[model samples]
Target: MSASELPYQYIVLRCVPRPEREEFVNVGVVLYCQASDFLQAGWRVDVERLHALDPRVSTDQVCAALEFIDAVCAGDPRGGAASEQPRGTRFGFLKAPRSTVLQPGPVHGGVTTDPARQLEHLVSTLVG
Candidate 1:
């Protein structure tokens, strides 16, 4: 990649309504680029996909978790102390070291000239 292109990491946020069965649906994308000091997330609740997995699944916690991710990306104080740290820390904070209703998948990276565009592309590809 060109020098102008910075490397970035991203994780897919998923909703595992049936963790026992290990079933999940991609619900969001979090992208972070320390070189550009950029961090952002994009998400959507695909009701049809969600319902197909578990019609009785409640999304309250999933929605809240997604909102928290967005707040962290926005550098909102409400995201708590982690939001006050550097972008790299914030990115690592969001990565799921443990499984939850709203869990983060594996860490993936790529070089991109524009992090924003890359995030959008990922959201469309993986979260759709």
Candidate 2:
């Protein structure tokens, strides 16, 4: 890797309407670059798509979860104690597996100088 490139890791966030059936919709992405001290999240909710998967899914709850991701990434007080940790700890917390409507896909890695742009690209390609 060139000096201009920095290592980063990311996870594609998923909205699992029905965990028992294992059905999910790609919703967002969280990315962290330690070298650059960058952490951010980008997301979009396709209400129509989510409804098609499960008409009973609560769009409001899904959106609230996504907002929490953003707040955590920004280290905002609204994110609660999780946002108080260091950036790396915050990333680990977000990526940890959990049984919830909003779930992390898997950890993926790559090199990029611009973590923000890479985050946008990941969200567009992986979540869209």
- List clashing residue pairs in candidate 1: none
Whose TM-score is greatest here? 2
lDDT of 1 by residue, 23-115 (tens): 999999999999999999999998888889999987777788888888888889889887888888899999956667788999999999999
Model 2 misplaced regions, further than 4 Å: none
Q: Which residue pairs in candidate 2 collide?
A: none
Off by over 4 Å in 1: none
lDDT of 2 by residue, 1-128 (tens): 99999999999999999999898999999999999999999999999999999999999999999999999999999999999999999999999999998999989999998999999999889888
Residue 52's C-alpha lDDT in candidate 2? 91
Number of clashes found in candidate 2: 0
TM-score of each: 0.94, 0.98
lDDT of 1 at 7: 95
Per-model lDDT: 0.90, 0.95
